[model samples]
Target: MVTNIAKAILSVLLAAVVSGCALGISEIPVAELEKRYASNPPLYIDVDGLQVHYREEGKDNDHTLVMLHGILASLHNWEVWSRELAGRYRVISLDLPGHGLTGPANFEYNTENYIQFINSFASRLGLEKFTLVGNSLGGYFAWNYAIRYPQQVEKLVLIDTAGFPLKKIPFPVRAFTAPLLGEISMHFTPRIASSILLREVYAEPSRISEAMTERYYELQLRPGNRRASQTLFKRNLEILRQEPSGLEQLTMPTLLMWGEQDHWIPADPHLKRWQQALPHAKVVIYPDAGHMPMEEIPVRSARNLHQFLSGAEITDTSE
Candidate 1:
């Protein structure tokens, strides 16, 4: 009877494995996902072998603003802020390489690749010189862009930027950057991971809704998006190891905004570093906000941004 019981347990385990394999989560159709997530169908253009996706709104005068989204975040994150700024300056936003409808492109896919992509995209769009704004990973690229091509960026805005090393990496980034586990995760990621990420980014858990989390999950499953995400996470880890140089060297009129309650990377240490590096930078902190202050307090952030832009003269950085 004991031997029969052991045999039954083994049989059940084998059946479970088979069942899991059969019922594995599969890629959702891009058409279906775009229906809900792609609120506005972005205009596409080919840039350096990738069919780039971007939106250009607001006035077409010389005043221009180029915005970049964070890791795993698309141009949609700037929806609220875009509405506020688009009326005056020409606001252009994009999906950088590995994220959004832009899809994944074959490249080294490092921070450098992003820098080059930005250059190419701007060149193709005939962007002479524009204020550059970025958040999180987007902010990481923004500073690097400013440092490398100072001639192209008129002003810099960093929202919870990620150029410096971190005390602890976020779990989604950690999990996706792991070796074999990262590979397996592309196929079997749990839906709950999206909820956890959303909650961590926002100060108030109430801000995250089921529909928001659902959209994030659906976007991650956008064909090659998961694999691109893994590559981006791994590459960023490698970049963050080295302390970035030339923070003080970025002399462009700078704006640094931080959410005081940000859990990912605390405000004090990073903000202090920014203050030391860019002494003349205009700083703003939001008390109740988390990592995503732009989303949490769009109107306030927009008002601050407008005030800064209005006061400062738009320099011809293209020279």
Candidate 2:
């Protein structure tokens, strides 16, 4: 019943309405995060035009332990350990560039980009040297950073890290890394997506909880986070091709914790490579754990980490 001009105008208005609603809903402020739940307030530092978000807990005199979360994960991933370790150590957890409340990096998201972020973050905090613990992508960054700046890292811990190439990629990874398909697929991620991700990450699916799934979903919806995740996924493929030889050069005391049931990076050959490269490294594989051993077996993992950092009686099985 409407004229062509009226229809065109109506169509434009409708499109704008939808777009506006989408953006408005997606734009979640960093400050509002606390209102939703009890979380450590974010400490911000200016770096390359971006306000980096980090949390520091415990006394300043205790040994510093810097924890890095995996890809698509924020500092909240270390909440359990941060609380447990705060009594004995100065625990610091940061949301890497392009993730969590940190926003996006000014430069490309890659290993070198992360290296700069870590160094900058450390310098800003006046951290001369500290123990580094990283998981998954964080582990890769930790290994790279430690290799380049051995003196800056007192000890290193890698959990289900990605450094070497694999013959077969996991289903989720394969789907996430695909071209146009991946972009389209991200919008369709449901509440079940977190469960699927957790299932793949943990050897025991029973370990996953509704609360964990809810946290992941809530964080993913943070302003600009999903786009940044996509950017990271795309850039990581290029970074993986470089094959940094720094692993063989590491001399610091290292701990490798992995889940025996990790589908992403199988424990067999990858662990062997780490063992061979890091002759001084101690390795522990949790039989019931999956890709994220720390979350799956926090007690045992934390004990091992505490012992390693304290220079207790540790066994290096590879030797």
Candidate 3:
């Protein structure tokens, strides 16, 4: 009986290994990714020796809006917002060093390095001052940039930003940060994993279209992106551990937006903490939205942003 049980366990383990191998993903060529995702010719700029993927849209105006996406997300996440705001304001979105088509970076993906990189990118674009907008980890960068370089930022918008220390690391992030598991994950990341993450970010899973999932999964398979993302996760863990400070210094016109259904960075305590820090900030909570209000409910969220920037009364438009 004992010998039979041992054999059964071995059989199950073998089956699991075979299943995992069958689902393994491989890196997609950069050219192919560009063809699928980019315009006639992909827009790229040399920042810190890396060919950074970016998009600049809207009318040529003095008022500029620079948007940043969260970790594991690309500039494409801001497509709706960029389109809605582009008519009035010069909107620019970029794939950060690791995420999106930007792939890996020459320098470290630490806190200070990213801040400097943003500054360099802005300098290259000859942007004197612009409204800085970011979501999730991008929001973390936005607030920090506003705090560090107060004069250059006219306004700040943070959507489910990460500043406060997390009680526990999310499973996906934790898995990618682990030594052995992280290396394994780089090559074996399946499409289902990407879909699950996308659903988690949306309060309603129905909002995640098939094309969106495909884009995310394919981007994760972009050459050099997985390794860079792994490195970023490790660096982010260290940064998240440090207690958040300097928030009180963000006296600029600040707009804090959070999704009430956000599981990643729940609105309860984190929103309250941000409120206390930036008492003057205009706060908006989307009732039916999750971590990404911009992506989940783009139209209403974009309207609120316009109202905030235009100094109009923020109406209760919950969708």
lDDT of 3 by residue, 1-319 (tens): 3235433543544465667645356689988899888744588999979888999988486789999999889998889998899888999999999988888998988878889999999998999999999998899898898888999999999999999987766656876886756766776776766777786788888898999999999998998888898888887896765679887789999999999998888898889999988899999998899999999999899999999999998875755
TM-score of predicted structure 3: 0.92
The CA root-mean-square deviation of candidate 2, after full C-alpha superposition on the true structure, stands at 8.5
Could you tell me every candidate's TM-score relative to the true structure?
Answer: 0.88, 0.85, 0.92
Q: Please give, for residues 1-319, the per-residue lDDT of candidate 2 as tens digits.
A: 1134333533544465556533133455656654553344537888767787878888565589998998777887787787778888999888888777776678887778889889888888888899999998899999989988889999899998888776565554555666644554445444555666777777777777888887776677667777778778777775554555857778888999988888777888788878888888988888778888777777667777787888786532321
lDDT of 3: 0.85
Which of the two, 1 or 2, has more lDDT? 1
Each candidate: RMSD: 7.8, 8.5, 5.2
Worst 10 residues of 3 by lDDT: 1-10
Q: Which candidate is the best by TM-score?
A: 3
Clashing pairs in model 2, backbone N/Cα/C closer than 3 A: none
Models sorted by TM-score, best on top: 3, 1, 2
How many angstroms is residue 278 displaced in model 2 relative to the true structure, after the best TM-score fit? 0.6
TM-score of 2: 0.85
